[model samples]
Target: MPVSPAYRPDPRFFDLGPDYADAVKAAEFPKHILRHRNDRAAAEVGLETLSDAEWIAHLGRFEPLPGQPGPIAMRYHGHQFRTYNPDLGDGRGFLAAQMRQVDASVDRPQATSARGASDRLRLMDLGTKGSGTTPWSRMGDGRLTLKGGVREVLAAAMLEAQGVPTSRALSLVETGEALERGDEPSPTRSAVLVRLSHSHVRFGTFQRAAYHQRADQIETLVEHVRALYHPQVQPGDAPGLLAAIVEASARLTARWIAAGFVHGVLNTDNLNVTGESFDYGPWRFLPHYEPGFTAAYFDQFGLYAFARQPEAVFWNLTQLAGCLKLVADAGPLTDALNGFGPAYIRHLRTAFLDRLGVKSLGEAADQRLVDTTLALLRDKGEAVRWEPLFFDWFGGFSSSARALSGPRGKVWQGEAFDAFRFALFEHEPECPERLENPVFARPDPEEMLIDEVEAIWAAIDADDDWSIFKSKLARIEAARTGYGLG
Candidate 1:
């Protein structure tokens, strides 16, 4: 990731301390950083800037820094997969410290929040996953699997590379613990604490308060999010404030669809009020034309399938509306709820077209463009393979198909569109023709699971060489370019 302007953590909310070794172990974060075996890898990700002592002090313990306040466990409640569960909150996670005065784009206040053009604000609750249970775990363990950490890291990086707006991982550690789960030998577990643009507040956060009739807490939380994320809104106007948040949430969820991502779990608790993507679990990008693709094993009914994500988001927003009703201003609130469908569709169009690297769509009406592309991909029957076409074409790395479907259609050589034809913009596509040709590849009814994906990455991580991965990325870029969306 490219470095933004120098940023500082909020001193009032954090206190940096020394007794972090035990806390690190207790949190089950990987000791890999302490081991420093791959100093190169560590440095590649900005850890090299920290002195050894600073590294231990900042990351090891949940300590506050100078001018920063001490840590506190945040209060929240969430629904698990649509079932109303009011007892969930920061079971193991806590607000470690706040990153104050940053000029990072994610830190930039949303248009609703930038009244004075002052960009930075306080965003806390840097969640420490695998920290031993606090107030919320219920019957479950607070520990997370090492494989889970790896999967999250991969998901964040890959999604960001694909231009998906998401929470970025700050640090991942290999806590030297042997907790038996499944599939692995020792079932080693680890900790991955992330630096999120927003944290700890969820739709369940509001739902919990509203359910218990704690209108004050609900109002307080809403004010805090508005100040931090939607600063432009006046707190006194409860209905308008609720409307802005609803619109933001709806639009954020629409981007998920534009990118073909499935959250797999859309519980009220998992939905962040800050309009940021959080809680990565059982998430998958579509690999084929099937709109009903689901990433979660437990979703037998496809409650949160790829196509259903839009509706799921609106459903969650309705729960938000119910919570807003507690404020006793239901007039404008109803209008906002009714506006979700149209607003979501508008945002989806903007985001997906932007991904194609197009400035705007023309009025000459290229309806066939979308239809033909989908048909080609469906006929080719390789959804995962279809991604490469966009990567290459949109990146301006391929041009072989530039004349395709033109009046001089004589350039067409065969019935099937040659995937490698676009590669002429760079050099001859290096992969074998059989592999590049759309005919030989058949789409199987394949659905990628977390474990299956981990196995693939395990091989890559085990080898410690990224040439293969890099080549694979290049192939994907070529394919994306072919699809006019690299």
Candidate 2:
């Protein structure tokens, strides 16, 4: 069945043709065991009515839905871990299809300032991972461990609850196989993943064109981006478009920092052009506000460390700017690249305040509040954890008492909260009622520490028990609702 009237078929990426992608077949699994599905994300693209079995049929087995055909493996090159790699693309996955979604612009008016907003451009990409091998699969078998899928589901759900712009795990299916991995135990369970996001186009897509000296292809790709994603992009204004993307990346980066998220691999291919975070591999949520925290174990040099995320993002943006050099003026593109730092700093302060459900008291006051809040957390040190600090001080310092009653109250009510409390008095909360939730009054807010994630996984690995996983997801969902973030 067609998803909805809003599901307009736009096979735009194919216009770039053979050089850009290769047709591929999805691997058929012996069993299509459904692991997770996001009905909320489904309704955004008008596919909410899908049954569990139907989801597996489409996403699991790669059955083409109305207005879409077989999946195509997109081709591009990227800088993985800061080194140029020309062989990368959808090595284990492909863009299955694209569809337009219903608009909620009225619910997000600030979006208009960027491009006046458009219902037509509200798009979603159906992409898969570990479903099969493709032209881009270099030497490795295209398979995903079930544990990997589980981790992804948890990561996306948690990030969404914290209001990070991230891809949702629309469907995850156990594929009834065993896979070997260096990181996890050998012969782990296998699964296939379906992800829903704004777009899969990455900075490396342009890098490939520029590398091959295809100025014409670069222009074509830029125009496609303008028409499909950023309609407000003025003609011949490639630099302007890059500037807009920088602003978006900065906004999301700010949110990531605010949420204490560290995307272990910030490779060029992993950073989508639309600024939506996807391909959750080795992501981690910090236990405390430690800048030097590194998520990926092999990050020996710690290039994409927690605190240097802003720097890494700027570096990737410069690479995108470098690609634009073929079709746009170098000076303007450089200027756009230079603006990232300020944009990140500005949005970070505002995002920090907004996350607390507090109203902005202009730039100066907001900066002071954000700076003071983070400083207080650092000052509090090892005694407090990340989530609890935000929990106690949510809606600013007014919720302190409610925050303290929780399991960690004694530690949360430390002396550092004194300056933090005064910091809250200067501004009104955007939503005071959020503090009324029972979550605030509890002795402990739900925490997703590494130990907790491992415990949940251990239960599954031991007895195939999903009770703990389900309960944890439910608790995270409750936190999402209680905080009024969703």
Candidate 3:
């Protein structure tokens, strides 16, 4: 195993003791065909140098990294569709490994300072999906459909490109198995997915402690989270911890709105304490701006619809606050929970502006731009696609000529966009140079609509042809580079 120097294993979650998780073994599969490998993410954790065989041996077969212990199945309970489920846990996956990785957002110069090094490097986790069954399997087979893995990989890539804080799909290995899933075609293929994320500590982690009436465990959990993720907060400041999560989660929700993403399930377990999106199940990117559009077929009431996402997130925050009440004052927790509305509004403004690639004229003007843009999108109905509107008008008025002549030009020419056009022209482009990227020159933007996703999977399923999937990923990478939204 030729591991890079950047590989620094730190299995910190084990410090929480046996109550939080149980050590588990990966299931033996018949095959280990590599479907996708994220070399970019591998480099971050110093595993990029591994050969395909080595990669399969480690990620596919779940061989523990050097100095790393076996996989640990984390335990927690969460609300599924607002219904409390005590049996919910990592039924199919486990926290395989933990390590420190360079935070690319930090400046190298500042990294030399005493506090800078720690800030520059973040603790990342390698968590598995469809790897195997665990104590929490509950009589169900621990398997992930191949289509599910592909969808998640695509979702993670597009979300990252859109500057949304999300987990990176590190690896996907097709295991030789046939599984029957009611939602999809019978006897579908199976694969194991590995995700690289900031932390696996979910909102449900705290809920579990509170549910058990273990206030002492809640207190310890608070300390552990604050020490690793939010060091700025005082040791006993549980309310402050809740506030940090609230702010991050608010910003994340706003980003999802700007990206036209409907996270089909916004369950407490799906949302980590770090506010980074992960465990994507039945996620969808909007084709058009429709508030009532939903991603999951089972969401009969549209509780987590496109427009209702903000409300759903706020509700989840209150759940977390309820758990915090076990160790902290209710007044402070409620105050922190109340911050979601204001924080969401502020973040929505920033997120929309960033997506539009425009500089904010001022708070008032920016709000108008956001408001008018959404109004125009709503007005246009199905006549316009969501991503192309941003793609065409990126950099505001600077790209007006291009936007007016693009494929959606006819829609833009209508009277409905008059106010939106005026609002957009009021601001200048933030990164004018990004307009030169070849991705923006194309007639259409790269989109991950449901139809396109099905097409890509169809190619793979019918003929084992991965060209469409690979090409789409390449286009997404190009778009990510061109947008330069980060």
Candidate 4:
């Protein structure tokens, strides 16, 4: 295989030794059927040139990448729904390989230089889902349903398109096997998914060290995170590191709100130190601005619901702060925690305005626009959809004529949106040319609701048809281009 010059293998996690992860072997499947491949993402890491057979050999068969270690199952303990579980770890997946790649800010904010240095090379991980069983599998089978893989791929694509920092779905291969799962119909097809992410070090990683009372290991882990992800902070400044994590988490949560995304499971293990949203399960995009909407059926109490996400994130940060307490003092850590609320409010205003495609008119005016928009959505209830609202009213008053003439125009004309309309007129559109994209001419914006997701899966499950799935992704790509959020 001809590896491109961009591929720079960096097996730094392997250097962390056995305390952080364990070398493991991948399971042999009956067959490997390539289902999806993210060439755009693959090109970023120089894996786009691989032949289909070669792609399967490495990602599906789990063959080690050049100059990289074999599959290593990461070890960590996390709190599930506020309940700590020591047995939690990489039960079905492992870190397959690591490499350095140029920053690919696809529909995301531009990367900034850390410590005033042009550090464009980002450390990325080629991690797997449903690859095989590991020491953390307990007694259950380490497998993933084909439907689950499809859902995650869709979730990642939509989230990325909406400018949310998330893991990119690199490859998804269907393994010829039937597995029984209680969550879905029994005897479902199985698959393996590979995700590309900046970092795989989760908050649970620190918690595991703290749980074992290893202050030395906690210190080592902090240094590792600082050197790799937060180089802007000074060495040995644990409090600064925590504060950076808090800021990132706050920004991510704010982005989620702007995108109308509900990350059904907000467990500590699911949140990494980089604050990029990954390991998506039962994720959903809101149809309206309902605060009580939840994606996971198991979340009976709405712990990780649409509105409580910020609270869930803060609680998780507290747990992470607890772990850091093993190495740092309490005063600075508390101060770091104190930053979450204000950071979230600021990021939320910015994210909300960005979605509306409007320029901010200072903090007070921006807050009013955000508040009025939410109030209008809540007042209208389920009468209005989420994405279309942003799509129709994009560019503030510049889009007034188009929005009033478009679908749901009557809803916008109603007295309920009067305050929002007045507030929107105060700001001008940031990029009026983006509205010229053909995707804006469509009757309704591209949405990934549950019924549509089920329909897409039904086509695949019943007749092995992937046309709808492929078409949906293409449409989403067009929307990404139209939004031009990056």
Candidate 5:
């Protein structure tokens, strides 16, 4: 038998280099490398052969880079639920390392890993819990709790399985350190998270640079984003680069909506310039379609509510556009703004239709059914109830199919729906077999918010009884894979 090529990590991402110590005062996690291993898939990668120490050393290696900010800090400002906040940067997290052009087979995007590359943007950051302050720590301890780490892992994994583009957890290790906090009982424990994704640059990053009037840095950061995520831009097409960013953002927000996910916070700092979803906390997945369902306890105004997400994204983009105006003209930028609505609508429609296994709305009636269902979901506050509808109908041939087509068809025949339905299915193929009755077998309302999920995790941590947690994960994973989200 022929010998295989020596196993290696993606060459592209082989240490893109980090701008370490550029802004060192902002660094809290003293350069300490923690040893870790791939308990999951080291075998497949042929990395199982590495001794434990070898793996740990590889995981712990941190190379500093030229021109990299000491804190990996970029400049930008952002709105917190529509309020202008001129002060914000990596308040707690710091860019620990950067792997350039890492080939992540998982996302199929050759970009720096968010957490670190195991086919994801693998990034390592020390989530400070009272790590004693930084430029962005505001008035509180920057410490994050162990419970918070657990919650973030669940949120990121759950959302990712649900077809939501989100941060992936590579590691979550408790730091044996104490810190004070008002949010939690004092002497908080900390954790480190290694995220996998394309990039971690945020709307806040751009906002910070813009706020400081560092137009040169803004331009540099824009180029960095483009080079990493949207390298298709021709030599002189800066406007195209901006538009590409806008388009990516639009598609991302649309996916969040289709998956029934509410980010809870769309703060400029939380909005990823790479158009990736970041900073998961107080996030909620709708059990029922409630327009006012708020995820964050702090979001008392529901600014990042389920229904307002798209609007929030558009608004964020407008803020980003303002920053871009420092360098670009107004006219083409206006064109980019106009693209958000239609592009988002198109993305949502395609993704939603795909989940239903509806090849095309072949008739106005078919369109009306979906439209009516969505309306009812929104009005009655029951979006999660529709999940089974997708499973039943799209699974093909069930009692629910008859309910969808026979008596229930009258909904589409109604005045408002009649014309819309006709136009919808006119050009599409019909899948009568795919229709299913919207029967809800369970009486209890479904919920998947951070707090609700934390309850399940509590059991896992306390008793290590993971039966319930495993079942929930299975159901959500089934939903994702069934709909091809996985």
Candidate 6:
């Protein structure tokens, strides 16, 4: 196993003082059943070398990695359902560790030699949900139901497969315990989940400082973020950090919309500073391109509905901008916040094309294509669903006419699809050979609908059956490959 020097860990969150975090220990469980492990992500942090037992000990047992001392529950406050709540923090989760991931995604600059890999690295945080309790437990058990853990596992995988910038479920271990919950059956299963994300610091992290009138801490946070996440942001460049975060947030919002995912909760605390989507509680993929689609059963006002996602994201960005007011002037922060509209539109158009597996003809033609496609989906309404339409015409104008003539082709009629076809024909295909896979040869693409997800859970609940869940993951992987997104 090869390790990169990027594995160097710098424990910075503890610098915020004990007010920000409480050192915590993992709960002892009767059993540690390894359910899912993302080797791909493990490889990024130089941990793919660990054996299964060692992996469980490190992730599940909370054994501190090299340079990591212990876990700390971060402090923050956020507006839950638009009401500011100071009681909120990592009630059931904590930052387990932080490491630099060797990122091979960047292009080499002329200043570097071409023989070696690009030394650029991305900072990653190991966030464990339902691991144990800390100062912010709030009188609730700090354990996750096994079914809830499974649901989150599926949610992260599906989102990643659809090209969304999302946190990955690194490891899941069943802590042989019976958990009683009102949402599901009583005495339901229990487990621990570990999520690997770019950063655990949320917009609300700064909110807490602002709430306590701690401008100095806010400025310190700004400097910390600038040094770690955005080196391009020079010293005392508050506006530059805001712009970088805004751009990332804009892209994230657009990607979620393009993927047809409704993150039921868009609260500031759940919104990461790095702009990667994590902390999935109540999330859903739209059955169709319905704007009124709501994911949370308790979200009565549709605040975080499918169509209102971009709005909610921008609103969170505003709250983040408000925190930046402590260090930066209001003028430049407002200017950066105001850029979200145009940035969202631009990113949405590009993301829409990318999701459909098509290359852009140019800005004008691509925007036209995006507009027509969305217009068609809106007009079709209940007559068409989201996943199948893309599955039916993945290659756009050059999609298999024969494949369309099958069950998926039944709805390929009408003026809505006609407009889409004409607009799509203007652009070249991104990966035409993607349709050649046997997965695409089938009638339906891999979809993560509510019923399908429930059915998967039912299997787990009955006789410890995991075949359905495993096969579903396999199918989703095949779909990801079929879309040429792997």
For candidate 4, lDDT tens digit of each residue in 1-486?
A: 545555667777888999999999999999899999999899887788889998999999988877777999999999999999999889999999887774545332222211223244688899999998999999868888999999999999998888889999999999999999887898999999999998999999999999999999999999999988998989999999999999999999999999999999999998898889999889999989999999999999999999999999999999999999998999999999999999999999999898899999999999999999998888888999888888889888888888889878888856659989988889989989988888888878888888999999999999999999999999888888889943
Task: Give the per-residue lDDT of model 2 (tens digit) for 336-449.
Answer: 988898999998987788677788888888887788788877987777777777776778657756665656666655566676667776778777988788777666777767
For model 3, residues 25-129, the per-residue Cα lDDT tens digits are 999999999999999989888789889999999899999987687899998999989999899788999999988785546442221122334543688999999
The local distance difference test score of each candidate is 0.55, 0.82, 0.90, 0.90, 0.55, 0.83
Q: What is the lDDT of residue 115 in candidate 6?
A: 20
Candidate 3, superposed: residue stretches over 4 Å from native: 103-120
Off by over 4 Å in 1: 1-7, 11-48, 104-125, 182-186, 362-379, 383-386, 395-452, 460-486
Which residue window of length 10 is worst by lDDT in model 6? 107-116
State residue 287's C-alpha deviation in candidate 3, in Å. Answer: 1.1
Name the candidate, 2 or 3, with the larger lDDT value: 3
TM-score of each: 0.73, 0.94, 0.96, 0.96, 0.73, 0.94
Listed per candidate, the RMSD to the true structure in angstroms reads 8.4, 3.8, 2.6, 3.5, 7.0, 3.6
In model 2, which regions exceed 4 Å deviation? 2-6, 104-121, 412-415
Model 3 lDDT, full chain set: 0.90
After superposition, the stretches of candidate 6 with alpha carbons farther than 4 Å from their true spots are 1-8, 103-119, 400-403
Off by over 4 Å in 4: 103-120
Q: How many pairs collide in each candidate, listed in order?
A: 48, 4, 0, 0, 49, 0
lDDT per residue for candidate 1 within 220-261, as digits (tens), equals 766766766676788756677667767777777777765667
Give the TM-score (vs. native) of candidate 3: 0.96
lDDT of 4: 0.90
So what's the TM-score on candidate 1? Answer: 0.73
